[model samples]
Structures are given as structure tokens and as C-alpha cells.
Target: MFFKPYMRSLAVAASLAVLAGCSSTGGTQDGSMDGTGAAGGVGTGTAGSGQVSGTGMGGNGAGQMASTGIPDVRTIYFDYDSDTIRSEFESVVNAHASYLAGNPNARVILQGHTDERGTREYNLALGERRAGAVQRYLSLRGVSPSQVEVVSYGEERPAVRGSNEDSFAQNRRVVFAY
Candidate 1:
């Protein structure tokens, strides 16, 4: 239950070193936390030009048009302890569904997340349910089940780091990763 005075100082130094190591910027071509570029698509470009040129969809398929259209909104938030899609996000889901249906070659991963509140197992199941809800919605809209995958990170990854209502609301959601 207690540490020697020297041991306490050593632990503090180690913690500070780890924190310092974590503070460096990422190496992504685009300034996103994820290494996948701005559009999350396979693209080619010269360095420092601020332009990407290539075939296929770009970063998570955002701004890339399919037969139906492009889906700019790739994330939809959820309420506490619920897997139901909110009314406001219906259109967003619809757009993504249409895009997938229109482009058979396109594939997407639905990542489900939840706020930190429940037990680990409970949170993981809740995340899966949230993602499955979106997958079902897409299927009903004419998207093939084969083109979509679902993953549950639960409370492992938080969009905003905090223990507040705003942070919780932001964390509970499904993201369409192309």
C-alpha cells in the first residue's frame, strides 16, 4: 500500500517520459489522427501540393460521388443505452446506403462505439448492437450485406476525452469507415 520515497520519484519520472513520447505529431500525409489520408481513399500526389490525384473513393469516401451521390456525413450519434438510429441521421444513412448499392465494388466498416459507463462486456455488446442497427438499415435500403462489416470498439476509443454529458454524447455513435 505504500512505496519507498525513491520508488515514488522513479514512477513519476517514468510516467512523465511516457507522456512526453505520446505528444509527438502523427506522420499522416493529411493532418488526420488516422493514417488514412483526408478522404481515406487510395490516392497519389506530389508532396506539399495539398492535392491528391488518383482513381476510386477518397478519405472514407467523403466527397466522392457514386451513382446515387456522395455521402458527406459518415458518422451518426446515439443516445444513452440505445441502439436505435436517431431520426435526424436517417438521411445520412440513406445516402451511404445508396452509395454502396450504386457501387458494388465499394466496401464499408461500421464501427460502433459507446460512452464509458457500463461494464466492458456490456459496452462491447452495446457497441455491436449499435453497429448492427446501422447495417440493418443499409440492407433495407438495397445495399448488399456482403459489402458491409461491423466492428465494436465500445468505450475503448473516445472521440472526446472527458467525463461529461457532451463527451458522452459525442462518444456514442457509429462511424462509416470506407
Candidate 2:
């Protein structure tokens, strides 16, 4: 009951072809051969490093992971009784500018605070001025005006509750919240 040489050779060739096809087009995690996830293996939906199933490509792949959550908050300090942005805070402003530039849909609320010095009305004005100053700086740096909202908390929200210089210094600052 031996088959002919040609028939045996044909059977072997067919088996090899099937094996090659199976290996080349691997199944996804869901057991689908269309490069999608079958159950435990990599997802065929998208090629990414993370195990999470995404519809498209995963992380940025340029060594930077895509932000899956809210962006981190960045704070910048101002001089005592002044709303002017300090030179040291240029980097912080630039970072905010870059973020706003990259994410047009993103927005920030700039809260200005002042130390307990003058009357509440005066402090309010000072805080407002401070927030305006920061807003101008960010605008100059290319951040859209619509992306930033300025608010002056005045002496209402002090960073450090005290009458000392250290507390005042801490209170006199601008906070950026997203």
C-alpha cells in the first residue's frame, strides 16, 4: 500500500506550504490569524510595546510614552509685590507654551496669589496684574490666548499661612492648573 513517488512528494510539499503560511501570518491574542489579539499574545489591532489593547499604534515609539492621563502641573514664582515673571521662570513658561502649542484643545487656569500686605482690594488688583503679566508672557511665547484663563485669588489662598517673610514669599506666586 505504498504511494507513488510523485504523490508522496506532492503531499510533503503541501504540508510545508501550510506550515510556512501558519508561521508567516501569526495569529493575534484572540486566536485570529489577522494579526489581532487572540487571548494572551500581542494584540493584532496595533503594534505597540504596552500590553494594553489599542485600536491604533501604541506609544510614541520615539522613547517617549504617550500621556495616558492629565498633564503635570507646572508652577512659576514672581517677585514680591510684583507680577512680572522672573528670568528663572523662563523654562517653566516655555514648557507651558510648548504644551499649549502641542495640545490646542488643552486649557489652563492661571491663578495669581499675593501676600497679606495691602487692603484686600489692592491685593486683588495686584494678583490680577500678576496673572495678566504671566498671560502676556505665555502669549508672547506662542500660546494661544484662548487656551489660557487668568484668575487672581489675591490673598485668599496663601501658600503658607503666616505673617513671616517666608510665608509671604511663598504666597506671592502664580500657580498654573490644568
Best by lDDT: 1
Q: What is the lDDT of residue 114 in candidate 1?
A: 81
Of candidate 2, the 10-residue stretch with the lowest lDDT total is: 26-35
For model 2, how does the per-residue alpha-carbon lDDT over 24-94 read when each residue is reduced to its tens digit?
22211111212222344332222112222212222232212223333343666544433444434444565
Q: List residue ranges in candidate 2 displaced over 4 A.
A: 1-73
Q: What is candidate 1's local distance difference test score?
A: 0.59
Q: CA lDDT of 96 in candidate 1?
A: 89
lDDT of 1 by residue, 67-160 (tens): 4655767887764444545434555676788889989989999999987765767678768867887887788778999999999988898887
Off by over 4 Å in 1: 1-70
RMSD of every candidate to native, in Å, equals 19.1, 27.8
TM-score of 1: 0.62
Model 2 Cα displacement at 166 (Å)?
0.4
